[model samples]
Target: MTATGAGQAYGIEALNVWCGLARLTAADLFAGRGLDPERLDNLMMSERSIGLPIEDPVTNAVNAARPLIEALPPEERARIELVVTSTESGVDYSKSLTSYVHKYLGLNRHCRLIEVKQACFGATAAVQTAVGYLASGISPGAKALVIATDVAVVDEKAEYSEPAAGHGAAAMLLSDRPRVLAMDLGAFGNYSYETLDSARPSPRFDIADVDRSLFAYLDCLKNAYADYAARVTDVDFTRDFDHLVMHTPFAGLVKAGHRKMMREQGVTGPRIDEDFARRVAPSLIYPGAVGNLCSGSVYLALASLLDSGVVTAPSRVGLFSYGSGCSSEFFSGIVDEQSAATVAEQGIGKRLEARARITFDEYLAVLEHNLECLVPVENRTVDPAEWEPLLDRVGDRPEILTFTGVKDYHRQYAWR
Candidate 1:
């Protein structure tokens, strides 16, 4: 199908997110951990998706992409020549996560399968890479699937990072049908440097320097946009785009980033507040509800904006993505009137509501096994029955991809 809006050719065709079936309210988490309640407002999170022992990055990727793949006609699905999985939660050193995802998704064997790692920015990088390939005439009328998947590894020891780190995946289809966001090809910018602001040094441990990460994030936001403005002409931070979306580690940082940008453009006082309300606030709802989705964060932000009922017209949108270790990009796209409704039809809100909310004690029960999900093992098995408390919450939902066990170092999975 030819995309009907925003100078179409290549962009997101369909989108979906899968966050497993468990969730925990940040307020409850704060209370249980003895974290100061007053500081909760700074993170602006309501709840976060919890990764259970039966769920991992692989399960997350497959679950997110299954619906999108299942919805396509045979011809369209067959044309999906690339599958790129971006993640910080890889299960193996040599075998890319895309291999397992590709197996479960049952894509055409002729397709290319790959994985990416640049921390939270990996998904954006995956999106751009897919776009580049589709745009390249190397394959005519082709399609690609990009999934940003991750699992939460932090606990109370990681402190605030524990609540802010969410688990799930965002899957998107890219083709000539730019019905969602018609990416402004070539109008992009980049910034990067070696910094240990945050790092997952092991499958079971995460180290973060709050001060360093904060400074790096804010610093990258400024330089990345500056690079974009330097490359693209006739752009105004305040006047050019109808909305703004950014990689939201926490919703408050988005507020801070937008405020910084507005100030750079001499947009002060009430105008900044007014502009933010109209453009940015709509994007924060999902991020706040789900915490940071890692590489999936920005896409969730986009979904929040589209489903927020603020999109009544085709409008330009500015997007920024930053990853720790650190890479950043500033880019944009256009979304027409049809985009919002298309997203709404996906029932994102309904799915979010369906997630089972568990208590702090239940969270504690699953914590140990959850972190062991990625540790390499030659022989191991995960009993779904052990995860019944969390799984029972979404038991009514049919056909969920699950991790069963491993045989001879190869991971095994099944649909429950």
Candidate 2:
């Protein structure tokens, strides 16, 4: 009895996503720090990194969601009753990122706009919250928009964690008649606690005690998986689930977490390695390419799996989500029949290919500009004549929300 045919009423309908990566290689990241190449290779196991120049969390969210929102039938798009954005990279303290997303998407004015924050777990929380809202029947037949967006800022000086830093965002639509995947509402488990293993006390910097954070991640995975195992009673991570997706802070940690989870389910040694190589490792393609997406990592992994064509109707896909400071959840969702068909039609690969690559020097300049933007200066205004030509250098991608500049102590953005 797998969680395959549970007849879920609410689940993901479509996933519209975008990743803004400036083309700097992992070698470039290490070279910037004057670090050992071999060590960086082992830690990150990633080939490329992405950089964002004028894109903030808001623009990232808009770029991620706009395509899908526009593809929605006029009626389906109009029925959107809620917008939830989850990010630790939020630009505004009082105003939720949803305000920008709502306005840019031209969503109905009556939609509820809220943001969720709990380190990397915020997006998963937002997704679960959306599911709950749908279940509440407050707005039956209306859909919910949930976006997990973040830009992992790189501090080249920080050798231990900088290589894996990446910037990306994912937007998902949830409703009862999901065209993507139908979640098993009953097969869910969650765990949370307080720990300072990782944090971004400063908006631009991420401080992590690497060892402690990995330990906390493993602990959260253990507790959440235990809770899920107890509830399902018949799940075999190697057999019952077609794919296993986890929040990838980096590639190595995900491999370690997969081994640990397999060992606990009474599978170990060669068998654990085998299952991970086949079932789990495939999900890492996107992360392995794009690097860490902060809150967007897990869903990005899911999108990678969907693109792989291995998941099909009735296949159970297990997901383990972790957020440092710290929380975790273990859940499984069944693939709907239309999921693979929908995924095949998606433009994720095309978008990734279309991103403009920047040189190592260019990447550094972008970061420096972001750092400069951080120091608030009162009454600082940009003359459009002076900045527009510079902003145009970032390329003109259609429908992409570009961070124009700041005026009156407010950050400004416009669509490209």
Candidate 3:
């Protein structure tokens, strides 16, 4: 189970991260929204969330990816063999988001483009797929670009759903040299089953049996961890991993899953609480502030932890990724020797700090604008020139990519 002799050639080279710039504090969202204030207060407690405009999903992918792509020496960028976009928030049905992203980024025309959809687990699949491709002997010096981006748009009017909804994106550059965590393909732990934990029959919003979804997530964690544990006996997970990063739809579920996982693994008592705080709490900071990014959530947690500069090479990080409807995996990777250099280059912290806090009213307005984009462009008699600027101003952050209104059935996006 150790990476030795496991042939871990395709490790992450670089990771770029970004989140929705518009902020919504949970307390402000429920202050006077025609609800039982006390109950809403108890539900969200004192948490804040962020949301992206409907168009921002693709924009997020591009904005997040541009940095890593630009940072690459031109020769490396030219040799990119594959570009894969993983998301639950795709702008077009007929054409993959990779098509737009590939063109916008001006990648080599010969590169292959693909899009993956499997709720939040899509990005993991993309990374694995890239690993498989490299294992198959791709062109020399070729690399793969895997981008996980998503926006959580729920029924803003529904109190239970709004608190868990948020948006963000992360882009990873996979190559032979490891700058970030070197993935161990051989030691993956996975669990999958058919269940109606969460689904979206229509494109507008997701409907979830929260209680069922939470149970499934924890159960999957237990099963996947057991599978992985059977192969690697040298380290007890609680005592080994420097950090445990879990997909966070909201913070409480992960905390609950942590306790359940410990009990299932036959570990107990005060040490469990202490281990959770030391190994798991650091990964939650960004997710706690940003809400859920669906496909981007798990990786975002890892990126946030590494961006802190506290974790270094040779440290093991346990990661659990869950995609509702529902697939989950428990995997682990070792931080690389060059992690400090990678973290120094990543702009995640700066982007997050630059984010603007907006009123609950502004959040609602952005929600309404996103809902409007859901309507088919063909159905509306709209002129792009008139509405483009208005939509571009949704999040109001300068220099980032934004999605403008559709023009003659083609979705429009640009850096503004």
Candidate 4:
């Protein structure tokens, strides 16, 4: 039987994040690389998720989602009729990452699996698509799994991008339950245009125009919010939304975006800071710790808010998602105490704290192989034992999905 009821409600029923097993403290990385100390404060980040050779998009997606899927009852699991994966770090041009993720997550065979690519905007697109699917009367009780997974490809040469880039996935279950976030359906704003702000020309590398990217991000936020204001009724940027979450490439950018919005509202002096401290600071906690989760940034921020213990009562959350080359949307959702309780149950903060903190040198050593995650290789293999020392540092060594190797131009994975 369909788990969804006739009473109309649909959005993210459950949500979880996996930012990998290790992190490099941003301050240490900056110091080791001889970067400016003031910039570290400007970045406003503590660590960046360190991608390992033993992990890839497949593993990350599986690990991020396994907990939710395994905890699902059989009938409910079967209701997971769709899986949409969003990524810019794709492993193959011909094959979608959803195949491996869906298989590894042990979802029902009868399911719709697809992938969406839009830089940081992909997650929102996938979430909206899933919500729409479930809201469609044809699939009255269906649930969709939306996963945004990626591997970091930056190094010291990437300058600031290196320290701000993160590797991982965020899994969201969309159904009529909407336990975590009850979306304000039909309330959304959009903006997009052709601009070479940033892109990955090859699986091996990425190119970006820092200035252009920054300007585009701010522009998108402003216009998108204006578009949203036009569409939604009685919208007050500072008053309507109890909290605000934006696609964060870095925590500092979010602060800047908030400032732009406040300035638009003629907000000045300490009230802007007061509003940010109250409505925006909670969402930055996770992004500051794990860097950017690419398309998952906004969702991670939402998770941060949920885990922030702020939703004592029902709260309205304004969400903004932007991707470069460049598309954006401003949307709204409702969160309650249940949202806080469910996200807290995931213990995201504790898990992040538990990651093995690697030094800059150690981070360098691992990047050589981790960077190969998206490369098209005919025959390659990875041994978990090769990285046991790092895992040893992990202490608990939870069994996460691991990338074994590639054989016959195909990727292989296992639990370890």
Against the true structure, what is each candidate's TM-score?
0.97, 0.92, 0.90, 0.97
Q: Give lDDT per model, in order.
A: 0.89, 0.77, 0.74, 0.89
Q: Which scores better on TM-score, 1 or 4?
A: 4
Deviation from truth (RMSD, Å), model 4: 3.1
lDDT of 2 by residue, 204-261 (tens): 6778888899899999888897788778768666677778889987878988888887
Off by over 4 Å in 2: 2-8, 372-396
TM-score of 4: 0.97
Residue 70, candidate 3: how far off, in angstroms?
A: 0.6
Residues 305-335 of candidate 4 have per-residue lDDT tens digits of 9998887999889999999999999998889
Best-first order by TM-score: 4, 1, 2, 3
Q: lDDT at 359 for candidate 1?
A: 93
| lDDT tens digits, residue span 1-416, model 3 | 35322654667888877786666667676663655566553332344445545345677888888888988888889878899999877667778889888988889998889899888788987887787677667465679999998766576444676776767788888888767877766667788888888875555777788789888898888888877777665657667677898988776778888888787678799978897787887777777777777878888788767866567567878899889878878888778447746865866666665566677777676676565544556533323344344445444355667676577777777666
Each model's Cα RMSD: 2.7, 2.6, 3.1, 3.1
In candidate 1, which residue pairs clash? Answer: none
Candidate 2 has its poorest 10 consecutive residues by lDDT at 382-391
lDDT of 3: 0.74
